[model samples]
Target: QATAMSVDCLGQRAVLSGRRFLYIVNLDAPNEGHRKISRQSKWDIGAVQWNPHDSYAYYFAASSNQRVDLYKWKEGNGEVCTSLQGHTRVISDLDWAVFEPDLLVTSSVDTYIYIWDIKDTRKPTVSLSAVAGASQVKWNKKNANCLATSHDGDVRIWDKRKPSTAVEYLAAHLSKIHGLDWHPDNEYTLATSSQDNSVRFWDYRQPRKYLNILPCQVPVWKARYTPFSNGLVTVMVPQLRRENSLLLWNVFDLNTPVHTFVGHDDVVLEFQWRKQKEGSKDYQLVTWSRDQTLRMWRIDSQLQRLCANDILDGVEDLIDGISHLPEPDKTLHPQDSEPQHNSGHGDEEALKEDFLNDPLVGKKTDQLGLPQTLQQEFSLINVQIRNVNVEMDAVSRSCTVSVHCGNHRVRMLVMFPVQYPNNAAPSFQFINPTSITASMKAKLLKILKDTSLQKVKRNQSCLEPCLRQLVSWLESVVVRRTAWAFCPTLLSSL
Candidate 1:
């Protein structure tokens, strides 16, 4: 049976690792069909991964006893290009950098992780030694320099700039960690499965403890976050049964699985979420099992989209329920009752006219209201709002405001409709700090937009949460830069 398997980023091919042969399957033409690449191995192949950057390269790496083999596709055949040798023991796992086409990182039972440049395989360009042998390693999807490794019960986060020491370390599991994967949308969030019969979620920004834990009665062999949703898929080894080991969970609500996939006659070795097809509204999950068979499970669009919003709605409902409880006092102090007024109506009207004349103004609104809910939320946080220009047409409402949070400044254009906090969702866009790279800006906007939409969908004011997240990210960036400045060795090397 194959012990390791991987699907290419493009979802066009899959590679399965067996004892002495590698099976490459053409996903697009399964019947035409599979090819076997022969290799000499004393033990089962440990891991296999395809280059994530360029589909045209068709390059992949497979790890086995003390070595990694790099192969390139030539006329439908995998030709061995190079062999990376460094580990003194069996290699455990490997991953390709999301942004670097030729960069690969492999972990081994020798307590060492090697970073290789596939173009020059004479030796690894960088190496990291851990306290214990590592079982799995993964690269951050959003941050190029950040990577993580799991050894025994500890998970260590490393920044490539400072390879000598880990940036953050935490005792993640009570037993051996079997799988690790980062959240697709959040750079700081990661998930891990363990032999301790549990799955854990962590935010690297908070190193002392995990963000969430999913308890299972059976040993979890693998847990992975879905590509476009907050859902997680886990493969568990049931104590008395081999069937119904695959479960789909909503991260926010772990009390129950949203759905369970049951079909495998034996334990699932590995499972991964395939890339969504263009114009398709659903996602496909592929699983390889000890049954010597592979199966693809299709998740409908409704299930995927429900993950974030449903979780947020549950939170909103809980808050609403708590807020309805009796309070200790009914009377407000005179100081707390002081009236606040809008003082710049004239300037706002002028700005509204200017915005209305813009070519991008697809819709307009005139009935714009500054909800007291938003005002109170902002005041409690002491978030400074500057250059507030409110505008509206008959159909839509919007405002351009500059937020001052400590030393960070963010300018955004917020658009709302009359049914905001009920039926319509708000939009947020960056209007200042045009200096940020396109990729960075896009990620920022995506987080903000998702957050705001979730809030509005719950009929709650969103500006506060959106602004809070932005400020938090900015603060984290500053902290990272400060830490980097103190590493003179890293600075000199760079």
Candidate 2:
């Protein structure tokens, strides 16, 4: 029986490990092209993963008993590379680094996490002692030197520079953790699935508690972040049923799944998202099950579009007003004495109906009496506005809006002159203190000013385009700086 499976980063092939043999299938023609490579192992394979950095290398590792066997694919056959031999106990999980192609991390039941340089397999380059025996390990996608390990009911985050200690520890669940993964877009965010029948999202920077929790009646085998969005996919065994348990959820809203994939007849051992093909709008989800079969589920444009809308809608519900608290509080506020509508506390049903009836349902920027062409272009930007507070000054013909992006907040103050959208340019300034560097802040302001002047010269609206440019700059800078800072000193030491 097959116990472990993984898809390569390029999504061209998949590898499945059984009791004493490895099977390789070309995803393009899965059924017609299948090859089996025999291995000398008495027990079943525990875990497997392909090298995620290089497409031409085609290297993979398979763990069994107390050792991990490395293999390279060439001409439809797997050739044995060196076997890494350091763990005294069974190897539980392994992962390749996102930035460094030769770096690999492995966790074992020996209560240790080992980082190895595949080029020199004599011994592990770094060893981290864990609080308990680890069952899973995953590298952060947005951070090069940061990684996480799951042991017992807790998850630990480690910086490669300080291998002797963990940077943060979170008591995630009451039972053993089965899976752990970092968010693709955010460096501090991560998700964990446990045998305790719940999946929780956490921000390591704020370790006091989890951000969100999704409770299921059955054990969730794995929970992973989607490649292109904030959605999550999980494989679980439903309360009384043992089949068809793949579910997709919007992390912001746990009330319901956006879609459920139902094709597998037995418990799914592992599943991965295939890289989207060129010019293809749909994404493929591949799964291997205990029923001795592999299946692929296609998520079309309609479903993806719905998932995106659902994310924005959920954010609107969570943070519609400036004073809206993320969590409910029983303590009364002074503003509660005023009328509900004026105080931004209208009926929930009425708010929902208003959102449904709004003409700008899927738009990023709200209507501001701009031209039709300019309005459509501004709406096409793919940025999520967590919260917005607009202050309008009719006497001065000015507007100040505070926008929230991931962990960074920005405030924009624009003053429209008497000859706006005709000849004179609007004055723009960034008011709030952002965590970004001074140089980045200056660059953003310069871009905003330049764009505003260009719009004025063309005799068009400027606020919408300026906001869109700001969002784009914020996202790019955050992702790049965070990933660079995450590379530890140990990488240089090596």
Best by TM-score: 2
Cα TM-score per model: 0.62, 0.65
Give the lowest summed-lDDT range of ten residues in model 2: 340-349
Query: How do the residues 280-368 of candidate 1 rate in per-residue lDDT, one tens digit apiece?
Result: 97787777776666566667643454344221233332232211111112111222322122121100011222232442443322222
Every candidate's lDDT: 0.65, 0.69
Instruction: Please report the TM-score between candidate 2 and the true structure.
Output: 0.65
List of clashing residue pairs for candidate 2: none
Return the lDDT, model 2, position 204: 81
- Give each model's clash number: 7, 0
Cα error, candidate 2, residue 472 (Å):
36
List model 2 lDDT by residue over 158-210, tens digit each.
99889999999989899999899998887888889989998987888766677
